[model samples]
Target chain A: MWELIRANKRNSIVLMVIMASVLLVLGFVIGMVFFGQEGGFFGLMIATTIWLVLTLISFSSGDQILLSASRAQPITHEVHPQLFNVVEEMKIAAGLPAMPKIYIINDPAPNAFATGRNPQNASVAVTAGLLARLNRDELQGVIAHEISHIVHRDILFVTLAGIMLGSIVLLSQVFLRGMFYSSMGGSRRRYSSGGKGGGQAQIVMLVIAIIAAILAPIMAQLLYFALSRRREYLADAGAARLTRYPEGLASALEKIAGDPSPQLATVNKVTAPMYIVNPFKKAKQIKLSNLTSTHPPISERIKILRNLSQGASFNEYSDAYANVTHKKTIVPVAALSTKEDVPLRQASAEAGSEERLDKQMRQVGDIIRRVNQFIFLTCACGLKLKIPPNYKSNKINCPRCNKSLDIPRK
Target chain B: MGTSILIVFLILVGIPLLLILFVIGIYNALVRLRNQVDNAWSQIDVQLKRRHDLIPNLVETAKGYMKHERGTFEAITQARSQAMGAKTVSEAAKAEGALGEALSKFMLVVENYPDLKANQNFLAVQEELTGTENKIAFARQSYNDQVLFFNNKIQMFPSNIIAGMFGFTKRDFFEIEVAAEREVPKVSFS
Candidate 1:
């Protein structure tokens, strides 16, 4: 998993650099056409400068922006001690440097999301319905899945994708405006004067520019969704690894899938893929098409998890996902039950080793107490007496008695 | 002059459009990643608080029957205090670990006094604690997922550029390093 994440990090850096250069080249091209070579160079520099500034602002205040947009309310330990404790537990488990602030949204939908630029500044928010619905193990599965995203650095990819998409839309608008403005020029100025080939070339370039403007955002969206889906699957596997229980997450997914609540009011297409489950609602009993969906089909995901319980490795899981693109079989609700509830005995046995360790510690504490109870003796002179186990070899002392005394080990 | 116009059109009009689109894309992506992180943490917080709230009730119920086990009671009380007073992730983890240790001890003491285990109030508290433990696990899972998303953004490429420029850094996953920390007594040797 670590290796995979490391590779992803490397890939993302290259992707970002490529994206920046692409944007810079585009800026330079625009500048040259409008104002000549020198103007083009200046335009490129300006665009880069603007991008740098925007990136800075986005990084610093992104979390706060998300929190407010989600309408999440900050909670104290007093207001929600259970949530605080769970966050504390995960922070230690994940080796985070600081506790992320906790928030709750009033929505009844059983959904949760994490926001922030990084670990220290991160925040997690969940709807109220999720709290009322999920059991302990299922909930852990969900939380672990989110943490896996954080650990793998999928957030960076998603953020960059969003930025790229936004830029594409803005540029398209500008292009449309320029096209409209250029069209208003007088037709009397001899179309033939520029020569046939040059006119053709001009037309072609304009076509290419318009097409690129239209296609870039679509391409970016596809890439963004692709990344989101892959990360979700990876997170599921990571969550299983973190909790050491595939069933927990599988069950949580089932619950989320079963819930029919509409997506949160604040969520839109761009933000939808980041959620644990797709927050949007489709027609009940309607199978999801893989081509259009932001998430992997839920039924397929459940199958992979069940396979994991039967000892399938993640590589197999991925392979299965890749190979099987058909509409998923709807496993009966009974089958869901079988996979959902982990038996108490199994849970205890899984926890048995630690329980034994705790027992041993308690026994040691008992022994220490018992030893303390019998180790001291009183002197007739009203001073405490101390003696070695081997009274003949070591002198016993009684301040008042001025006599050696014997003592025994408890 | 026509060729120049063509070249000029390509240079002047085509590129800025693309750059604007790219910026918008990056911004939206950042917003989404940030939201996921927030959601994940909230899940964890809710579960943790549930666990915390349950402790007092558990402690209170156990108090009456285990009257003779003052040391166990004190340990639990102290552990709760420490857990509650904990201010940082690591500190809370340590305090929670201590509290778990104390809680298991208290449960062990309750074992010798079957009456305490059988008490309606004690059973209710225990049931609630167990439920809270499950919730805590769920919340942790969700928090970790968001952490994964946020960290990935700060660590990954193009987003990392924005992430670094904006001082966005990788988030630490709230995790328990040792399984020993979560251990509760399974006194049912049977």
Candidate 2:
């Protein structure tokens, strides 16, 4: 595991350096286009400053931003004891230093994500529908996958890389839009006002700058997607190893992918990659776009997970991945070298009857209502009333018995 | 003469210093692994304590509807006490396995009492008991994993020499001794 983290850290640094250089070069060329040769250094300085500021913001409160963006409410252990216990179990299994704070999104989509700068400060957020749908073993599988992301330090890497990609995209968009609106003839005339030789060089620089602005974001995105896809595989392997049950994750992935619910309401392109399953309904249907996706195909991920037959070790996951994908191993060699024979454990006994499903659904609804400050009133006629916090009336008559009841005060 | 003296000094002091530093590095790593093993063991202890605390509530809840099942109650109580009194990892492992077996038997007998199954208190206790059991199992799994890593480090090459010098020893795994644990519970449908 340490080897995996170290390798991830190294690769992240290399990718960041490549991204930083791309940002700087793009800035330099754009600067040259706008202010002739002298503006190159000025543009480089601006790019560096922008990168630093964005990095600062993400490192300090990126998790908070993401949690709020998803409309996730902080949940105590009482809101869902089983969920807390499962997260605790995964924390032990992964040997994380502290428990990641738990949150519940109001959305009905069955998806989850982990976010923090590091494991110690991490938080795991799951949608309300996930809690209502998955059984204990399946829930553990999902939490274990998110915990694995925290353990592997993937959150930090993805945050840094995502910021870089955002900066590059933002810069290119601004430059392209500015070029579109402004006249190209003005820049050409402005360059010719300098000197003939310098004017020709400036024109060449402007063309190169336009081309760089066009291609830089694409190249950066491809790099980011390549690394992110590999990290997903590694996190999957880590999840299997941590939970010691590959089938749980496999089934959970299938359920989440096969869910017919609408896409998560708050999910945008920036936060889409953070989810366990791609939140975009369109990504799964298009095979060609899968290459540029931050995550590997759901079917491929599920297949790799199901192929882990022998045990839940890095080596086993690597073998299963190779068998399923017919590709090179994603797990680091050092991680695979640890010959810990982690035998898979039996699934926790759970009854998945229809009655149990209804009960689970009710429990999840109650939990969400509780978080939303809903007041519960039980009538003498056996009717349960759920009053929203914003209810204007102090008393309400039961629909069943027409008996007025005062709302319980906190 | 001066150059030769410098060469002699380099060979004598530089090499031994490097060796000591190397030994120190290995020793520190071994110590870290040892501490991790100790930490993992404490995690198991915590889950075991939780299991012990929940068993009485479980028995108390079941005692109401299971009037004729005195033997199952006594078996669970006895196993719980034994597990609590256990002094070492292997001892705790054996005691906990016995407790687990007794609890499973009690649950099987619970099937005969529909009233007890329907009681909300019993159901809550059962949920907590099962969650604690899963936690204990996961904790034990990780404990054993840490023990394996520590034991391997103390027994494997290069580090073994440092381990010997520092008196590092192998730790026992929390193994399940009850043969019944490995057996699948029979589900009979009449």
The candidate that achieves the highest TM-score relative to the unseen native structure: 2
Could you give candidate 2's per-residue lDDT for residues A1-410 as a string of tens digits? 77888898888899999999999999998888787788999888887888899999999998898899899999988778888989998998888889999999988889999999988999999999999889988999999999999998988887888888899988888888888766655655676588889878977987898999999999998888888888888888989998889889889998898888888999876677788888888655576565678788889999998888788889999999899889888888878777878788777666678988898888899999988988988899989899999998889999999999998777
lDDT (tens digit, per residue) of candidate 1 on A280-387: 877632574565567877776776776664333345444445545443422212222211212111242122245544543343333323323424467777675444
Model 1 segments more than 4 A misplaced: A21-50, A180-199, A283-292, A310-410, B1-57, B64-190
Error of 1 at A334 (Å): 38
| Candidate 2, residue A162: lDDT | 84
Docking class of 1: incorrect
Candidate 2's residue-wise lDDT over B1-190, tens digit each? 9999999999999999999999989998998998999998899889989999998899888887988999999999999999999997678789999999998788878889988887767877887887788888888888888999899889999999889887998888777898888777667898
Give the least accurate 10-residue stretch of model 2 chain A, judged by summed lDDT: A183-192
DockQ, candidate no. 1: 0.03
How large is the interface RMSD of each prediction? Answer: 6.6, 1.1
The Cα error of candidate 2 at residue A226, in Å, is: 1.0
Give the Cα lDDT of each candidate: 0.63, 0.87
